[model samples]
Target: MSISITMIIFSVLFLVFIIRLIKTATFTLEYSLMWLAIGTIMLVFSIFPQIPEYFANLFGFETMSNFLLVMAVLFSLLQLIIFTKYTTKQTDDIKSLIQEVSILKEKVKKEE
Candidate 1:
């Protein structure tokens, strides 16, 4: 199969947008790297359409598109798990800070 011009153009546009976002501080490097890597990979694949098919065959996927979808879903789930952990830690820290502040306020009131 041959790569389409539209796909290549879209991938390049996406890569450019991602870099602009990073430069503008809209997304930190760590947060933006995943999308940057994805855009880069898509740009590469758009140039070499056969690479994905080879990977699909090596992985026993019936189609390269299916392999791509599965990988996207897996990555999304992994990100969700990481975000959940980060949120939980933040919540706990907030609770601890609030409790400490209340205790300090109580001590100040007693002294006054």
Candidate 2:
């Protein structure tokens, strides 16, 4: 039970889960793309275990695991920021819609 083998198994399972989510409409394709890409990259690195090590050394990481951990953290943070921005925009849009409806209701009330 090597780390590489474990990674490969988990990556495949992750990809399958993402695909199933997309198929069932539980997760939108747009959001699932990032997860799919991550899973694919994990699978690739697992199959060719040397790639991460090479990149880790090239990037001055103390170890491949450290490099992977840093990259995953950075990627997750970026995704969180993007989703936050999206949520803010949606909130603003919803507020604007509510205001418009409120104004329309007021006008209807006056007419009545």
TM-scores of the models, in the order given: 0.85, 0.94
Candidate 2 lDDT, 1-112, residue by residue in tens: 9887898999999999999988898977778887888889989999998999999999999998999999989998998999999999999999999999999999999999
lDDT computed for candidate 1: 0.92
Candidate 1 stretches with Cα past 4 Å from truth are: 1-3
**lDDT per prediction?**
0.92, 0.92
**lDDT (tens digit, per residue) of candidate 1 on 1-112:** 3346888999999999999999899997787998899999999988888998899899999998999899889989999998999899999999999999999999999999
What's the CA error at residue 75 for candidate 2, in Å? 0.8
Best by lDDT: 2
- Candidate 2, backbone clash total: 0
Question: Residue 98's C-alpha lDDT in candidate 2?
Answer: 100
Kindly report which residue stretches of model 2 are placed more than 4 angstroms away from their true locations once superposed. none
